[model samples]
Target: MMNDEQKTDKKQRLIRKGKKVQEPVNTQLVVNIFEGFTKDERDLTQAHMGAEYFRVMAWIKEEDEQETIGVRSFRGFHQFNERLVFPLDCSSYKYIYIELIKVHSRRDPATSKGTVVMGRAKIRLPPWTSRGKFTSKFNLVGLNSDRCVEIKGYLNLSMQLHRYLER
Candidate 1:
C-alpha cells in the first residue's frame, strides 16, 4: 500500500501528464480496488468448481450523461488470473468514467499492502470494434482515508475519441 503522499504524488503526476500535451487530451478514467482472491484463488477453486467464470459489476460515469453506467460481464478464471484485468464493452456509450475505492480492510494473518492503481484505456472505435489499448499503474494508496490495499484508476476518452472520429 502507498502512503497518502504517494497517492497525491501519483495524482499530481497524472495531472502533469494531462497538462503536458499541446493537443486536447480527454479527461482520464481511474480504477482502484484492494480486496479479492488472486490468481492463486482460481487454481484452488478449479480443483472443485471445475472451471467457472466470474462476473464483476462496475459503476461507470460518462461525461455527457447524468445516469451512471453499470457494466457486468463474465470472465474466465485463467484469463482473469493471467491478465489480472476485466474488459468492458462500451461501444454504445458516447463517454466513459470509472473509479475504484476500498470499503474496508481486515487485520488477521497480516498481509502486504493491497493493490491499487490508475489505468488508461482505449476502446473499439469503428472499423475495429473488437480491440483496444489499455495502460495502467499499480500499488497505490487510498485517496479518501489513506487506507492501504485500495485501488484507483481512470480512462482518457478524448484520445480514443480522436482516434475513433478520425476519418
Candidate 2:
C-alpha cells in the first residue's frame, strides 16, 4: 500500500532509532588464565587474532532449524594487553563474530595479574539490528602456579562464551 520512497523512509527511521539505543564500552573486568604451554603452543596463538564476525544463533532442544537472535562482530588477536572488548550496546546476542586482524604470542614463562592489555574488537549490525555497547568479562581458569597457559583452554572458553544482552 506504500510507495517505494515511503517504504525506504520507514526503514531508515527504524535503523536510526536502533542506533540511538545501542551502547559502547564503559566498565571492564580482568581475569587470569592458567595452563602450561610449549614453544609450539605459543606459536599457535598466531591464528587466534584476526577480524571475524559472529552472529548469535538460538539454541533449541527440538530438532528444528534455529533462528538467529542477533549478531556481533569483533576484530581480535593476541597482543601485549591481551584485551578484547565489545560495545555495551551489543549485549542482546549470546555469541559474537571474532575477526582477527593481527595476532601474536610469546613463550616467556611469566605469571602475573592486572597486566594492562589493549586491543580493538568491533560488532557488526544488520540494517535492522540495534547499535549499542555492553560490558562483559573474559573468564579464565588455571592449574597450579604456572606461568604459561594452555592454548586449548583459551580457545574453548571463547567458543563457549555467552552474552546476556539487556532489553
Identify the candidate with maximal TM-score.
Answer: 1
Looking at candidate 1, the ten consecutive residues that score lowest on lDDT are 76-85
Q: What is the C-alpha RMSD of each candidate to the true structure, in Å?
A: 18.8, 16.2
Per-prediction TM-score: 0.21, 0.18
Cα lDDT tens digits for candidate 2, 1-167 = 99999999898888888476544334211111111111133344555433322221112112322322212223322222222333333334433332121112222325243121122122232222333333333322232226543322122112222244444
For model 2, the run of ten residues with the poorest summed lDDT: 29-38
lDDT of each: 0.30, 0.29
Q: Which stretches of candidate 1 lie over 4 Å from their true place?
A: 1-46, 62-159, 162-167
Write one digit per residue (lDDT tens) for candidate 1, span 1-167: 99999999898778888465444323322223222221222233344332332222233334232212222212311111111222234435442333232111121114344212222222332232323343332222233334344433322222222222112
